[model samples]
Target: MDQEDPGFSAVGEVAGDRVTVRVSGEVDMATADAMFRAATPGRVRAATLDLRAVTFFDSAAIHTLVRLADHYPGALKVFPSDRVRRVLDISGLGHQPWVSADQG
Candidate 1:
């Protein structure tokens, strides 16, 4: 599934029990909900969030990611862009086990 709106885009790929959601552009209050919906569709056992292309990430985006991480618990992984990483680091979630600069 893929959705695009102005400065934001979210693309989701499902493989068996895992879902990978790649998001780009500005992710703020306006697009946070849509990003959440894209990441959590149906009963996915695991989720990978790829935000390497995100140029801007806000608190709402962080909240959305937190919700998704909580929903999937240890099964959630995140690959963040430099901008997103700075925010996550400031917000104290950058060093979490689920968050990594490497896709692997």
Candidate 2:
């Protein structure tokens, strides 16, 4: 029997250098790469990651975000859920470009 596990469905919208990515499914080591690949390239002024629809997240996902922030200084923004924020906070990248979901 062949059983395949379907993964996350991330929707990304890009306008100019600003990109908004909405992740609805679990963000684990398996799926984090796709999200990073989907992000807008070349130093965007703003990047909004809407995780309001996300139900689960992991260290790899947080690592992805840290990489993005390091990838684009003063150009990466993350609109993370409270749960997500905790991860960012622990990673010490929360205060930089991170914004609360309701604020945006």
Candidate 3:
């Protein structure tokens, strides 16, 4: 349906050693790069992705986060929405230490 549309955005903020990215709308192939750039605008010791406002989470989003975690180790964290949590679970990425599903 309309779910296959491109409608993703990300906003990043740096506070001390932590970089927080608040993402809204949908995340797909077309918007993944934008999300990555906004989420990791610069190097930081800690990173948090606020996905609570995201209406949709797709494979592109998952891949981006996984890659980030791989490169940054404990530098990445996620505050995922229930919708995103389900996707992670289905994708077998729910157990990732970088993902905090308890934020709900």
Give candidates' CA RMSD values in order: 3.3, 3.7, 3.3
Which 10 residues in a row give candidate 3 its minimum summed lDDT?
Answer: 1-10
Q: All models: lDDT? A: 0.90, 0.71, 0.82
Q: Kindly provide the TM-score of model 1 when superposed on the true structure, using C-alpha atoms.
A: 0.91
Best TM-score among the predictions, by candidate number: 1
Residue-wise C-alpha lDDT for candidate 1, range 17-56, written one tens digit per residue: 9999999999988899988999998978999999999999
Between prediction 2 and prediction 3, which has the larger TM-score? 3
Better of 1 and 2 by TM-score: 1
Name the runs in model 3 displaced over 4 angstroms.
Answer: 1-7
- Model 2 is weakest, by summed lDDT over 10 consecutive residues, at 1-10
Once superposed on the true structure, which residue ranges of model 1 sit more than 4 Å away at CA? 1-5
| Model 2 TM-score relative to the real fold | 0.76
For each candidate, what TM-score against the reference?
0.91, 0.76, 0.87
